[model samples]
Target: MTKVFIIKFSIFILFSFILSTVSAFAQVDVEKMAKNFNIYLAFPEKHFQLKDGKYSGGTSPQDFANVSIEKIVIKDLNGDGLDDAVLVTVGNYGGSGGFYELTALLSTSSGLVQTNSIVLGDRINIKKIQVHSPEAHSPPELGLIKQNFEILIYMLKHKPNDPACCPTEPTMECFTIHKNKLIPCKEAPEPPVVKKPALYLYPIKNQEVEVEINPKGKVLKTIPEYREKWKVYVTKNGKINGKYNYLFYETTLNAPIPEYQRGWVVSHKELSRWFDVTLTKFGLNKREIRDFKAYWLNELPQFPYYEIRPLDTQFVEENLTIKINPKPATVIRVILHFKGTDTPSKLEEPAIITNVRKGFTAVEWGGILENSPNSDIKPQAKYSFLAQDTGVVVLRAIDLREHKLSIKLSSNGCTDKKALKSIVKKLEGINSQVPHYEITLIREKPDRCKALISEGTTIVYDLKEEFGINTKLPYTVTVKNPIYPLITDEPYFQFFPKKELKPKPVEEDMSLKEHLIKATVRAIEMEIKRYETSQQRDKEDKIDRLRNEIEKFNKMKPEDYILGYPNGAESSMEMFTYGPLMPPIHRQVEAIIEEPLKIGSILKLTTMTKSGPFYHIAGINENIDIAKELKQGRYRMKLYLVYKREYFGFIQNYYVYIAEVEKQ
Candidate 1:
């Protein structure tokens, strides 16, 4: 067996270590604020009671509904420096009818605390929701737009008492908790109507804009933008049966909710209105309609994310701007939250890595490795890498003065333990290999086998060829001593004939026709034997393999053959024969010339193997000339024998032409 060694050693050894540190970078602490604003974990059902008072506490096992967090946005409700969270859930719930909730959870050192339970929509309903709110921002505000965000809230028919129970016109409203009391805004205005404002609604700035070409000129995908905020209010003249109670509220005690004024209905209609205006007004296409069906804490299925009829939409942009808020604390709070179902809590679901550094950037500075000096490496016990839709392995490099290191984190593909260790050791060794040198080796071949040679790069090789009739040859390469191991994941090298193995090399030529005929005869013998011995065999498939192999040999020049064996027999001009083989041929037969040629044409040839005549091209040999020789009738052409068997073998010889054709 012929073996080839691939040397993938990088000489530039980067002296670095996978510094292990505590899990300090995973969270950003927003110090505790005023009293009475204590954070608690709500178990989705049973009113969100005080922490450890009656209902499940925050992040407790019982409260977690097994699910993944898709979206997490933070906003301040009382201007307290501390951020509150809105956790959006995704991934496997208890199948159909199982709720897909996106509750607004209050974030704290205590963990995610559910404030309001909102359902996104189901597979069927989600489509409709998309039509209603293609880019659903939690709360709709005319501001800068970013990602395609949509929100849909479906409420149950109000079941209240004393005239304020049913409304003539059912609309969305916001409920607030004050001094441990549920207060519904009675004076909340019906969903507002603003004729899709004529402000610039497209062309998001500072982001990659892909322009795909159709029959029309270049067109960009439309990306709708909006805000996630609301205005809260309280009114005594609350509408009952969609009409104000004339007797009770004759006076106007109109005032916005004190602390809750900014928190209002992140409505479904507003979402729908926005979708219509942006998608239709601009131009963006919807490829997927994801439905999210959310259930109440009681597991009562309600609110669907996308449930609008015929929700498919598309768009094109004009000009858009990203409203950069100088103070994210004022407009946005980066917090972590997870979405979940009522039954199986999604508390433990790994939070998706969002609005943070990409994995590539993080992997640098030892973030991707299992163990480092700067951090503790914990195996994500519950979720497999495949199940992780998104996750973050944060790393912070703080000098002695605690100044954050500005190094970029690059994601590397070394997930396995062995691979990761190799990388770490290789990098650690760089400092000694080459004190102050950097080298990069680029592969010359098509494959990814580039060599990065630097003073610090460590490499080892054993390029010796083995000799034996039937032997398992092994070619090994080990690179050490550099600060970092060469990151050559793949490499390739040309196989050259060993000098000692061949006493003397002689060049010879062979004819195409003669090669093809001899290969066919050999193939016929192999097929017949296989057919007689095998319990179940097809004669046609075998014949096909035979023919393909012969054609392959005819196309190749003998000199380029990897097999260094001399031609089996030499045939002279006086009498030449390749010898016949005994056979009731069973192999399928067909022939193909690599290059169709005229009389005076030159063609390169090679041979391959397969089970059937319709075999795929595998290997190739040298080149041959079909032109008439200077001495007429003296044909000098190379030929190769082709066979369809367990192993590939070849024979070579030169041929003489009996006749020649004149040039046209």
Candidate 2:
């Protein structure tokens, strides 16, 4: 009996040992699960960059590895505030190639650390999976109920037509829990409460605030108005606009009290209150600190109150001179004068003297030091002294107090190399640099003018007329290296340095062309006027003069003047003319010529004796030609009369008429 009991105990122990060994090797045999799933850490400080295997490149997946990524969200696997990553791996269970495992990585100080592999029990096949709500944080508990965050893992089953794989069949195998631990009862239904996304605000001082949502979160009322120290209302989509009021003050030259105090309005939607500001004051008030005087003030966004920085004031040396020689630039007026100095500290009104050289004038001074208007510096009385010739001005500040500052002043003439150098030196000292406008070129002409020549491109007339740029069409602007880089448009042109050529006097050539044309036109005009005057005199005189001129012109030979040919070639030339005839003669000729000329049956031409011949000429044809006999006073030349060719001695009659040949 003892021997049998001992054997039974040994058998039991052997069976337990076998079970333990199998369990330990079972998980190890399956393909090792992927580890180290992580989301980004604190904002821009600790951010994400794409890793080589599955992500990070250009616009496509195929790009250089190790691209810097901005941000990505991750969800917590359990109820912990920290987030977890989802990953996939395939390998042998115990050997090199057996099973595949899907796992997650959680955030750790050392780096991304692997979390426990979630089991997709009994399925044996998951084509794809996703984890949602990756980055969740714990909230301060305000009640007995602690805030619970959860992550959703979606698994795509590979079995086709299976209820779990077929969406139409609507079947799923889910392994989930209420919080971190497994569900108490697997039969319980998922909660139905809609979890709305909370709004997060990021404000930039003096700029707009931005808002965003993630993880398919919905915001029904993104613009919730909060009225406590300040009020907020929805100004734009998903953003809250707010406005607040605070006291603003400006001190006067008098030490007694500040000049003014009023509520200044401001708007803020930020978590922080401090903001930088600039003030521009315009009013119809006192002269010294009013009307046109503007002070730029910087202050905190929280208050209406502002502290006036030390005034940016510089005095020009009194007697400035600009020579009107060379190319006389349009001088509208001049301003250069001296003024007494005043301390910014104590309160007495700043002195204003006459003829302050203003407008777009530059001033030169050694250095300028101004105490903050709000600071404890005593105000000193200022006096002005003007010396226009030398361009030297002086401003001596005097007070009953012990401190005195005397500054030398010179005109701020950019043309004056020395003064410009000083201005440039002073400019370098300022923090926020502004390029001074020594000159601004503008085009205003036939069109709304354009720059025909700029930095380099050869501008065309049509381009100048239309786009005002040297490009044929409008360009799409793309920002490259923004600051100080040249902006170019398509089709981009390369600029080559061109040798500068001094302009020669084009006025002489232009003047010669203009005057020569003018003279010829004027002479032709004068001849027309003279002819009209002669015709306007007594009818007989006009007729006689016309007749005489016609006779002389027709009787004249085809000289060089008439032919206008230097060699006087007259091989095929024909000449003719006519003039007014006396009444009886004209009446007889009209009776002879009228019916035939009008009917176009025969041609009659009256010509001066000098017209050599009308060879190959014949009477007009009534059917194809048309003419009208002129009354005596309007007699003119015709070239259609018969003529004998002196050299050939050939008589050729042609159907020619004065109307057809000479535009009668």
Candidate 3:
């Protein structure tokens, strides 16, 4: 009986455990969830509020308010089986008005993530909030509304005319997660259409009148029209109710026009007085009316005076002078017109000149001139002037009298003689030397390699078949200065091929070769690092020594070294080669030819590896005769190999020669 009781109690405990686990996973704290999502609640603390239900000593009553979290709902979103939270919040200022907002939080593995927060309306009341989760289909998708759940919020949007007790109507809005953002489910309504007043132009006998008409075609009012043919001015009074907003030209017979006074209206109706009109009451679009106004007011007045002034008949002399009177600090542009094919010998290109002080400005003209050295102006050329201030000009181009003159000139960059000369000199002195060499090692066939050599250049040598040995090895050759130590400590010989070769190891010998190759590469890396560090240290030490010597020299009296023989003069003078060092078999070395090669300097060429020396040739004489012989034909120099190894063992006891041949 006791055993049965124990079994039954254990079963009850297991059942309770399972139920607790499920509850723990399903339960979510709404407040904590909202805070985790960074939900924007219209809480009273963010704005003005009343303190302690009364005004504080210095705090404003309207500036403080009471805020509260209204409602929160949690449901599975995106069919992920994880509950997401939505928050509704409201804030009430001391008065009757308040604010409403909605926030959404997505449930993530780490925590609740805030998706979106949007303000619904100011002084609004939220009536209802509901989460609509539809039934899942064969395949579930995540979005704002198509497949995922959405939150519908019913609210009363406060209007300006709404009474304090209640808003006029209820507004419905839906929101959901879209691209990680909370957006409205419905698009915003379109704007209301606005009606504009129609403008009409009427021709009444000799006068033209402009009138404003409503959409029904009834005349509203007639606008004032300018009637003068010559000397017409436009004046803009402020905007009028239902009147067309355009510039209206006004005719003033005796009054002078002001300078640079823009913003005036010039209408087609006012211009129709000077020009003939074909329509009585025409309905025109804004752009068409603007074009018609510009044509009559700005362009049509100049048509009657299109005649080009005759050259020989008007001007008897070669030169002419024009005097213009413009207001102070104003620019006057003068243009010239030429008659007949007789081009002017010398004419100052038309330009706008500013007059700093009020007085008569003199402009001289050399009759009908060419625009350029190769181009000439046409015979019937016309000129016009656009002046800022009211002024009269007397132009005497030989003896022609005209009120206005137009000249066109081309603008381009001016040439600088000094800059051009400097460029020409540089072009004439460019270097044309490109030194290159090709060497062919004679064997069963021929192993040939060609290269362009310069200071600090590196060359790679493929010596797999040299001396009739077909061993795979990596090699690099560099031109070096003999005086300087070798740039690298890695051996010129490698027992194994490079990593990119992908050599197969089927037998014991093949496996051994692969292992040796890896070992050689590792050794090469370490040696390269060691050599680079050593070179950097050497350069730093040399720089320090030079700095110290400079300091010592600066402190010394001029007579110390300049007046007497320097210390260790004889000991420091050592015989050295000035030409480039012979490059290593498989390494990079800088060619340090300190000065240009002298005719008789001896160059020592040596090739060695970290293991030991492989080849050394001393006392190579540099002479004009040898250079001439090399330039004419190829000459092979014998290489003496020493301390030969497995990879390079075939070359041992064999005469290896290389030629320094230049291409024709």
Q: Taking the tens digit of each residue's C-alpha lDDT, what string does model 2 give over 1-664?
A: 9999999999999999997777554333221211212222211111123233123333311111232211122445554544444444332111011122334454455645644333332223444343322133312221111122333333444333343212232223322223223221222222211111122122222233222112121112322432212133323221335432111111112111212222222232321121121111211113212211222112122222322221212211111121211111222211111111222223332232222322221111111112222222212312112111222122222111111111222121211222211100111112333311111111111111222222312111122332233233322221111122222221111121133233232223333233222322322232233244332335455445545544543443322111111221111112111221100010111111333232112223332011112222123323333334333232333332212111111112222223222223
TM-scores, all candidates, are 0.16, 0.15, 0.23
Better of 1 and 3 by TM-score: 3
- For model 1, the local distance difference test gives 0.24
lDDT of 3 at 76: 64
**Top-lDDT candidate index:** 3
Among all candidates shown, the one with the greatest TM-score: 3
lDDT of each: 0.24, 0.25, 0.31
For every model shown, the clashing-pair count is 95, 54, 22
Model 1 ranges with Cα > 4 A deviation: 1-66, 91-93, 107-112, 124-664
In terms of lDDT, which candidate is stronger, 1 or 3? 3
Give candidate 3 regions above 4 Å deviation.
Answer: 1-28, 31-38, 41-65, 93-95, 134-145, 158-161, 187-664
Rank the models by lDDT, top first: 3, 2, 1
